[model samples]
Target: MEFFADIADVAQVKEMQEWLPLDGVTTNPTIVARAKKELFTLIEELLAACEGIVQVQTLAYSTEEIVAEAKRLVAVEPSRIIPKIPCTQAGLGAVMRLSKEGLRTTVTGLITVPQGLFAARAGATYVAPYINWVDSMEWSGTEVVAELLAAFEAYGLDTKVIAASVKTARQFRELASLGTNAVTMPPETYKTILEHPLTDKALRNFADNWNGVFQEYKLDSKLKG
Candidate 1:
C-alpha cells in the first residue's frame, strides 16, 4: 500500500523527500494556496520534486468546471497528477466523465462509507475519507475507515481508500491496521514520525555498539585501477 502526506508548501515537499518513507501527495485549493504558488505552477513543481503520485484537485465547484479542470490537469502531465473531485453528485458526474477519458480521479471531502462506495461506483481511483475531521465531529471515525476499506475489497472496486486529514501517528496506525491504501497528513505529522523516541533509541543503540565489526575495501592501491 502507498502512503501520502497532504502538504502544501514546496519546502515541506522537500522536507518529505529528506524523510523519504511517504509515498505520495494530495493538494486542494486551501493547500495549494498555503504554498503561495499558483495551481498549475505547483503541479509542475510537484511532478519534479515527488517521485510518487500527485493527486491534484480541480478548483471548479460544478461538474462542467471540474471537467474543464480535469482537462487542464491532464494537459500538464497525465502520469503524475490524479484529478481530485469533491463528493457531490456533480463531482461524481465529472469523475465519471474524466475517468472515461482515462484520467485518474480521486473523490475527497467529509466522506462517509456510502460516499466512498459511490465514488468507487463512479470509478474513482482514490476515495479520501477524513479521519481527524470525522473524530472532531464525535463520529466513530475509525469505523468508517474500516468500513470503506472492506467495502472496496469486498465489492472489488479499484478505488484506493486514502485516509485523509490524518492528524497524528496513532490515526495513521489506525487506518493502516484497517488496510487503508494510503494516508495523507499535514507536514507537522509527517515530521513527527521522524522525531519518535523508539526510532531514535534503535539508532542510538546501533551506533553505541561495534562488536567485531569489520570492513574490507575492494579498491586497488591506485584508485581501484
Candidate 2:
C-alpha cells in the first residue's frame, strides 16, 4: 500500500511529499540524467528532501562491480538508501551479497513470476515489475502482478512487489485492488489518480449551496461565537 514517487527532481519530490502520502522515491539512470546534476549530489539532495527510503540504481553489470557500486551508494546514507539492481544473474548475486551485509536492495526490470521468485530467494527487499512493458507484449500486466502476489504469499516470502511503469489511473486502481505491496509512479500519474471530474463537480455544488445559505457567514466565526 506504499506510494513512491518515481522521480529524480528534488523540487518535485518535495512537492509530492507535501501533497501526497509518499513513502519514498525511486530513480533510474534515465531519471537521474534528466535531472542534469551530479549523481551523488542529486542523490544527496533527494535523500535530504525525502522522508523515507530512496532507491538508487546501480550501473554495474557484473556481480563484483554491482556489489561494489551498491556498497558505495549505501555508504552515502546507510539507513535510507536502497540499491536498485537489475533482474540478472549478476544482479541477483550482488543482491544476495549485499543483503547478507544487512543492506536492503530492490530488484528491478522484473516481468515474470519466476523472475520475481528468484529475486525474493536472493534476498531482495522489493521486486519491481514493469506493468506497461508487460501489457505492450500482448499480455496482462495486472495478471502478472496478481500472479506474483499469489506466489509470494504462497511461498511466505518477505520480498514485496512494487509495481512500476504505471501509465493510467485505471491501471493504478487495478494494481491497488490486487493489494500489491507498493507502487511507484510518475508525479503526473499520481495527480491523475487523485483527481476526478465528479469529485470536482460535487465540491462546486457544495460551495454554491453553502454560499447561498451562509451569505458570507464564515464557519470559523460561528465556531468562535
Candidate 3:
C-alpha cells in the first residue's frame, strides 16, 4: 500500500518528506486555494520537494477544458504529475482520452460502485473513493471499496483503488487491512498514525535503561583515525 499527503501547504509537504515515507501528494482546487500561492508554481514546488507523483485535480467542467487543463498541469512536470479527473461523465471521457495519450490519470470524487466501474473503464490509473464521506451518509465506504476491488479483479481491470477522505487512524488501518492499494489523507491523519503514547513510553524506557547501563563508561573526547 502507498500513503499520499492530502495537502498543498509547502511546510506540511516538507514535513511529510522529512518524516513520512509518502508516495505522493494529492491536491484539489480547494486545497490549492488554501495555500494562497500561484497554482502551478505551488504544485511545481511540491513536485520538486517530494520527487513523486503529484495528483492535481482539474477545475474545468467540460471534457475539452478538462483535457486542456490536464495537459497544462502535466506540462509543469510530465513524469510526476497525475491529473485527477472527477468521476463524472465528462471527467471519465477526459480520463479515457488522456490515458490513450500516454498520460496517467486518477479519477477522484468517487463514492459508489458505478463511479468506480466507470473510472476503471476509463483507464484511470487510480480510482479514489471518498470513504469517510460515504460513511457520513450512513453508508459503508469500505464495502464500496471491497465491491470495487472485487469488480476490478473479476473483470481484470488494472486500476488501483485509493481510499481517500480518511479521517481517522482506525479507518486508515481498516482500509489497509482490506487490501487497499493506496490512501491519501490529511497531514494530521498521517501524524496520528505515526504516533502513540505507548510507543513513546516504550522508547523512553529503552533509552533510560540503555543510559543507565552505560552511565559509568565514557568515550575519549578526541577522535583519532
Candidate 4:
C-alpha cells in the first residue's frame, strides 16, 4: 500500500522527504493555498522534492477547462503527475479523456461507492473516497473501500482505490486493512503515527539509560559513512 502525504506547505513537503517514508503526495486547491505558494510553483517544488508521484489537482468547474489545464500540467512531466478531478459527471468525462490519452488521473471528492464506480469506469488511475467524511455521517469507509476494490477488480476497471480524509491513527490503520492501495494523511496525523506509546516509551527508555558515549560516534558514522 502507498502512503501519500497530504500537505500544503513546501516546508512540510521537505520535512516529509527527510522523515516519512511515503510513496507520494495528494494535493488540492486548498492544500496549495495552505502552502502559501502559487499553484504551478508549488507543484513544481513538490515534484522536485519527492521521488514518487505528485498529484496536482484541477480546480476547474467544467470538463473542457479542466482537460485543458490538465493537458498543460501533464505536458510538464506527464508520468510524474496525477491529474486529480472531482467525482462528477463533467469530471468523469475529463478523467476518461485523460485516462484514454494515457495521463494518470485520480478521481477525488468521492462520497459514495457508486461515484467511485463511475470513476473506475472512466479509467481513473486512482479513486479517492472520503473515508473520514463518511465516518462523520455515521457511514462506513471500510465498506466503501472493500466494495470499490471488489468492483474495480471484478469489472476489470483499471482504477485503484485511495482512501482519503483520513484523520486518526485508527482511521489510517482501518484504511490499510480495508485494502486501499493508497491513503492521504494530513501532515500532523502522519507525524502522530511516529508518536505511539511504544515508540515514545522505547525512546524514553533509551534516552534515560544512555550514558552519551555513542552520540559522537553515531554522528561521525552517519556523517562519514
Candidate 5:
C-alpha cells in the first residue's frame, strides 16, 4: 500500500521525506490555512519537496468553478498535481468533466459505499473516505472501507481508494489489512505506527550485549588485525 502525508508544512514534509517511504502529500483548506502561507507559494514548495504527486483540494463549490479552479491548480505541474474535489453532485460533475479531459482527480469527503460507487462511475482517479469522521458519527469506518473495497472489486473498477482522516495506528493497520490502495495521515501518526516498546527494548538489549563483548573494539577494527 502507498503512504501519503496529510500535511502542509514544508519543513515537516521534508523531514518525513528523509526518513519515511512517502508516496505523496495531501492538502486541504484547513491544512493550508495552518501553514500561514499563500496557497500557490506553498504548493510550489511542496512540489519541490515531495517526490510524488501532491493532492490539492478545490475551494470552489459549483461544478463550473470547481473545474476552472482544478485547471488552474493542475497548470502548476500537470504530472504531479491532483485536484481533490468533494463528494457532492457538483463535485461529481466536475470530476467527470476533468476525467474526460485526461486530468487525474481525487474525490474527497467520502463516507458511504454509494458515494464511492458514484465517484468511480464518474471516472475519479481516486476516492478518499474520511475514516475517523465516520467513526465519530457512530459508524464503523473500517467496515465502510472494507465494503468499498469489496464493491470496487465486484465491479472491477480501477478507481483506487485512498483512506483519509486516519488518526490512530490501529486505524491505519485496519485500513492496510483491508487492502486500501493508499492512506493519508499526519506525520506523528506515521511515527506512532512504526514504533513499539518491544522493538525498542530488543534494540537496547542488542546494544548492551555488543558492548559487553566488544568493549572499545569495533567490528571492523577487530577484523583488521
Candidate 6:
C-alpha cells in the first residue's frame, strides 16, 4: 500500500521524506492557506522537495474553473501534480474531462459508495474517502472503505482508494486491514505507528548491553571503509 503525507508545511514534508518512504502529499484549501505564501509557488516547492506526486485541491465551484486551476498546476509541474477534484457533480465532470485529456486526477472528499462509483466512472486515478470526517458524522468510515473496495473489484475499476483524514494509528491499522489502496495521514500519526512501550524497552536493553561490552573497544583506523 502507498502512504502519503497529509501535510502543508514544507519543513514537515522534508522531515517526513527524510524519515519515511513517502509516496506523495495531499493538501486542500485550508492546508494551502496555512503557509501564508503564494499558493502555487509553495505547492511547487513541496512537489520538488518530495520528488513525488502532490494532490492539490481546486477551490472552484464550477467545472471550468476547476479545470482551469488544474491546468495551471500541471503547467507548474506536469508530471508530479495530481489535481484533487471533489466527488461532486462539477468536480466529477472536470475529472472526466481532465482524465480524457491524459491528466491524472484524484477525486477526493468522498463519503459514499455511490460517490466512489461515480469517481471511478469519471476516470479518476485515485478516490479519496475522508475516514475521520465520515466517522465524525457517526457513520462507519471503515464500512465506506469496505464497500468501495468491494465495488471496485466487482466492477473491475482501475481507480485506487486513498483513505484520507486518518486521525490515529488504530484507524490506520483498521483501514489497512480492510485493504485500502493508499492512506494519507499527518506525519505525527505515522510516527506513532511503530511506537510501543515494549519495543522501546527492548531497544534500551540492547543498547545497554552493547555499551557494557564495548565500553573501551573501538574500531581501528585501518578497519574504516
**Which residue runs does candidate 6 get wrong by more than 4 Å?**
209-225
Candidate 2 lDDT over 73-183, as tens digits, reads 999999899999999999999999998988899999998889999999999999999999999999888899999989889999899999999998878889989999999
| Candidate 2 vs 6: which has more TM-score | 2
Model 4 error, position 106 (Å): 0.5
lDDT of 4 by residue, 77-142 (tens): 777888888888889989878878878889898989899998888888898999888888999877
**Per-residue lDDT of candidate 1, residues 128-148 (tens digit):** 888888888888677898998
Off by over 4 Å in 1: 198-225
Whole-model alpha-carbon lDDT for candidate 2: 0.92
For candidate 5, the lDDT comes to 0.92
Candidate 4 residue spans exceeding 4 A from truth: 206-225
Name the lDDT value of residue 92 in candidate 1: 96
lDDT per prediction? 0.80, 0.92, 0.89, 0.82, 0.92, 0.88
Alpha-carbon RMSD of each model: 5.2, 2.5, 3.7, 4.5, 2.2, 3.5
As for candidate 1, its clashing pairs are none
Put down candidate 5 lDDT per residue, 122-197, tens digits, no spaces: 9999999999999999998899899999998999999999999998878888998888999999899888989999
lDDT per residue for candidate 6 within 154-210, as digits (tens), equals: 999999999998887778888989889999988888988868889999988976766
Ranking by TM-score: 5, 2, 6, 3, 4, 1
| Candidate 2 residue runs with Cα over 4 Å from true position | 217-225
TM-score of 3: 0.90
Write down the TM-score for model 2. Answer: 0.94
Report the CA-based lDDT of candidate 6 relative to the real structure.
Answer: 0.88
